[model samples]
Target: MSEKFQKCVEDFQCLNCGQEVSGNGFTDHCPNCLYSKHVDINPGDRANNCRGILKPINIAPKKSGYTIFYKCLSCDLEITNKTAEQDDITNFLITLKNQ
Candidate 1:
Protein backbone atom coordinates (compact mmCIF):
# COMPACT_ATOMS: atom_id res chain seq x y z
CA MET A 1 0.00 0.00 0.00
CA SER A 2 1.10 3.52 -0.71
CA GLU A 3 1.85 5.44 2.46
CA LYS A 4 0.74 8.72 0.97
CA PHE A 5 -2.68 7.44 0.05
CA GLN A 6 -3.03 5.72 3.39
CA LYS A 7 -2.10 8.74 5.39
CA CYS A 8 -4.73 10.60 7.35
CA VAL A 9 -5.73 14.22 6.99
CA GLU A 10 -3.19 16.84 7.99
CA ASP A 11 -3.71 20.50 8.70
CA PHE A 12 -1.29 23.24 7.84
CA GLN A 13 -1.27 26.96 8.42
CA CYS A 14 -1.09 28.97 5.25
CA LEU A 15 2.17 30.87 5.38
CA ASN A 16 0.85 33.43 2.91
CA CYS A 17 -2.29 34.57 4.76
CA GLY A 18 -2.03 32.95 8.17
CA GLN A 19 -5.04 30.83 7.40
CA GLU A 20 -5.33 27.36 8.84
CA VAL A 21 -5.88 24.78 6.10
CA SER A 22 -7.05 21.23 6.36
CA GLY A 23 -5.55 18.65 4.07
CA ASN A 24 -8.53 16.64 2.84
CA GLY A 25 -6.51 13.47 2.38
CA PHE A 26 -5.25 14.73 -0.98
CA THR A 27 -5.25 18.51 -0.80
CA ASP A 28 -2.10 20.49 -1.49
CA HIS A 29 -3.34 24.04 -1.86
CA CYS A 30 -5.31 26.50 0.14
CA PRO A 31 -8.86 26.00 -1.02
CA ASN A 32 -9.71 29.58 -0.10
CA CYS A 33 -7.21 30.95 -2.62
CA LEU A 34 -5.35 28.06 -4.29
CA TYR A 35 -2.02 29.22 -2.91
CA SER A 36 0.55 26.65 -1.80
CA LYS A 37 3.40 26.87 0.63
CA HIS A 38 6.83 25.42 -0.11
CA VAL A 39 6.68 22.88 2.61
CA ASP A 40 7.63 19.63 1.03
CA ILE A 41 10.29 18.49 -1.37
CA ASN A 42 7.70 16.06 -2.65
CA PRO A 43 3.98 15.87 -2.04
CA GLY A 44 3.16 14.83 1.54
CA ASP A 45 6.80 14.29 2.41
CA ARG A 46 6.93 17.18 4.86
CA ALA A 47 10.71 17.12 4.47
CA ASN A 48 11.12 20.77 3.56
CA ASN A 49 10.53 23.59 5.95
CA CYS A 50 11.14 26.56 3.68
CA ARG A 51 7.71 27.87 4.64
CA GLY A 52 7.84 30.03 1.56
CA ILE A 53 4.77 31.12 -0.37
CA LEU A 54 4.64 29.20 -3.69
CA LYS A 55 2.81 31.25 -6.26
CA PRO A 56 1.91 30.14 -9.76
CA ILE A 57 3.45 32.59 -12.15
CA ASN A 58 4.50 31.23 -15.58
CA ILE A 59 4.69 27.93 -17.41
CA ALA A 60 7.18 26.40 -19.78
CA PRO A 61 7.17 23.36 -22.01
CA LYS A 62 7.51 19.83 -20.62
CA LYS A 63 11.12 18.95 -21.64
CA SER A 64 12.94 22.24 -21.31
CA GLY A 65 12.17 23.22 -17.73
CA TYR A 66 10.59 20.08 -16.33
CA THR A 67 7.28 21.89 -15.77
CA ILE A 68 5.52 25.20 -15.01
CA PHE A 69 6.89 28.42 -13.62
CA TYR A 70 6.89 29.01 -9.89
CA LYS A 71 7.78 32.09 -7.96
CA CYS A 72 8.28 32.40 -4.30
CA LEU A 73 5.78 34.92 -3.00
CA SER A 74 7.86 35.90 -0.02
CA CYS A 75 11.32 36.54 -1.51
CA ASP A 76 10.36 36.84 -5.19
CA LEU A 77 12.55 33.83 -5.94
CA GLU A 78 11.87 31.90 -9.13
CA ILE A 79 11.72 28.14 -9.50
CA THR A 80 10.34 25.54 -11.89
CA ASN A 81 8.70 22.48 -10.54
CA LYS A 82 6.26 19.95 -11.92
CA THR A 83 2.95 21.32 -13.17
CA ALA A 84 -0.53 20.58 -12.03
CA GLU A 85 -4.07 20.94 -13.39
CA GLN A 86 -4.16 24.66 -12.55
CA ASP A 87 -1.30 25.22 -14.96
CA ASP A 88 -3.54 25.30 -18.03
CA ILE A 89 -3.19 28.99 -18.72
CA THR A 90 0.56 28.98 -18.44
CA ASN A 91 0.89 25.84 -20.52
CA PHE A 92 -1.26 27.31 -23.28
CA LEU A 93 0.81 30.44 -23.38
CA ILE A 94 4.04 28.46 -23.53
CA THR A 95 2.70 26.26 -26.29
CA LEU A 96 1.78 29.29 -28.35
CA LYS A 97 5.14 30.89 -27.73
CA ASN A 98 6.96 27.76 -28.83
CA GLN A 99 5.07 27.65 -32.12
Candidate 2:
Protein backbone atom coordinates (compact mmCIF):
# COMPACT_ATOMS: atom_id res chain seq x y z
CA MET A 1 0.00 0.00 0.00
CA SER A 2 1.11 3.57 -0.60
CA GLU A 3 1.97 5.69 2.42
CA LYS A 4 -1.16 7.73 1.90
CA PHE A 5 -3.34 4.64 1.57
CA GLN A 6 -5.47 3.67 4.52
CA LYS A 7 -7.18 0.32 4.89
CA CYS A 8 -10.89 0.54 5.55
CA VAL A 9 -13.27 -2.36 5.25
CA GLU A 10 -16.89 -1.42 4.87
CA ASP A 11 -19.82 -2.85 2.94
CA PHE A 12 -21.88 -0.75 0.55
CA GLN A 13 -24.56 -1.18 -2.07
CA CYS A 14 -23.50 -0.48 -5.62
CA LEU A 15 -25.10 2.78 -6.66
CA ASN A 16 -25.28 1.72 -10.30
CA CYS A 17 -26.09 -1.95 -10.26
CA GLY A 18 -27.48 -2.26 -6.76
CA GLN A 19 -25.17 -5.13 -5.93
CA GLU A 20 -24.32 -5.83 -2.31
CA VAL A 21 -20.59 -5.37 -1.99
CA SER A 22 -18.42 -6.70 0.78
CA GLY A 23 -15.27 -4.76 1.43
CA ASN A 24 -11.91 -6.44 1.89
CA GLY A 25 -10.02 -3.38 3.12
CA PHE A 26 -9.12 -2.51 -0.50
CA THR A 27 -12.50 -2.52 -2.14
CA ASP A 28 -13.27 0.77 -3.85
CA HIS A 29 -15.40 0.10 -6.93
CA CYS A 30 -18.34 -2.24 -7.26
CA PRO A 31 -17.32 -5.54 -8.78
CA ASN A 32 -20.57 -5.91 -10.68
CA CYS A 33 -20.85 -2.44 -12.20
CA LEU A 34 -17.31 -1.09 -11.92
CA TYR A 35 -18.70 2.10 -10.43
CA SER A 36 -17.26 3.77 -7.37
CA LYS A 37 -18.07 6.69 -5.15
CA HIS A 38 -15.93 9.77 -4.70
CA VAL A 39 -15.43 9.18 -1.02
CA ASP A 40 -11.69 8.88 -0.75
CA ILE A 41 -8.94 11.36 -1.41
CA ASN A 42 -6.42 8.70 -0.68
CA PRO A 43 -7.35 5.04 -0.86
CA GLY A 44 -9.80 4.18 1.91
CA ASP A 45 -9.44 7.62 3.51
CA ARG A 46 -13.00 8.72 2.73
CA ALA A 47 -11.87 12.30 3.02
CA ASN A 48 -13.37 13.60 -0.20
CA ASN A 49 -16.66 15.46 0.08
CA CYS A 50 -17.70 15.48 -3.57
CA ARG A 51 -19.85 12.37 -2.99
CA GLY A 52 -20.16 11.86 -6.72
CA ILE A 53 -20.67 8.68 -8.62
CA LEU A 54 -17.46 7.57 -10.30
CA LYS A 55 -18.32 5.99 -13.60
CA PRO A 56 -15.85 3.69 -15.28
CA ILE A 57 -14.85 5.28 -18.53
CA ASN A 58 -12.03 3.10 -19.82
CA ILE A 59 -9.96 0.08 -18.99
CA ALA A 60 -6.25 -0.36 -19.51
CA PRO A 61 -5.08 -3.89 -19.64
CA LYS A 62 -2.03 -4.95 -17.67
CA LYS A 63 0.00 -8.11 -17.33
CA SER A 64 -1.65 -9.04 -14.07
CA GLY A 65 -4.86 -7.05 -14.00
CA TYR A 66 -6.24 -3.78 -15.37
CA THR A 67 -6.49 -0.12 -14.45
CA ILE A 68 -9.92 1.43 -14.58
CA PHE A 69 -10.34 5.07 -15.49
CA TYR A 70 -13.25 7.00 -14.07
CA LYS A 71 -14.96 10.32 -14.25
CA CYS A 72 -17.09 11.61 -11.41
CA LEU A 73 -20.61 12.47 -12.45
CA SER A 74 -21.18 15.19 -9.88
CA CYS A 75 -17.70 16.73 -9.69
CA ASP A 76 -16.30 15.68 -13.07
CA LEU A 77 -13.05 14.71 -11.41
CA GLU A 78 -11.08 12.08 -13.30
CA ILE A 79 -9.39 9.26 -11.42
CA THR A 80 -7.97 5.79 -11.90
CA ASN A 81 -8.34 2.68 -9.81
CA LYS A 82 -7.08 -0.88 -9.98
CA THR A 83 -9.56 -3.58 -10.81
CA ALA A 84 -10.34 -6.04 -8.07
CA GLU A 85 -10.02 -9.77 -8.65
CA GLN A 86 -13.75 -10.32 -8.78
CA ASP A 87 -14.62 -7.27 -10.88
CA ASP A 88 -16.84 -7.90 -13.87
CA ILE A 89 -14.43 -6.07 -16.13
CA THR A 90 -15.16 -8.02 -19.30
CA ASN A 91 -18.78 -6.92 -19.26
CA PHE A 92 -17.77 -3.32 -18.83
CA LEU A 93 -15.26 -3.56 -21.67
CA ILE A 94 -17.82 -5.19 -23.91
CA THR A 95 -20.30 -2.48 -23.07
CA LEU A 96 -17.69 0.16 -23.80
CA LYS A 97 -16.79 -1.39 -27.15
CA ASN A 98 -20.44 -1.51 -28.10
CA GLN A 99 -20.78 2.15 -27.33
Top lDDT prediction, candidate number: 2
lDDT of 1 by residue, 11-57 (tens): 88766556687776555655443457665666666555476888756
Collision count for each candidate, in order:
0, 0
Candidate 2 Cα errors over 4 Å, as ranges: 1-7
Q: What would the per-residue lDDT of candidate 2 be over residues 44-75, giving only the tens digit for each residue?
A: 78888787999999999988789989999999
- TM-score of candidate 1 versus the correct structure, residues matched by position: 0.47
Estimate the TM-score of every prediction.
0.47, 0.87
Give candidate 2's total backbone clashes: 0
Clashing pairs in model 2, backbone N/Cα/C closer than 3 A: none
Candidate 2: TM-score? 0.87
Please give the lDDT score at residue 76 for candidate 1. 69
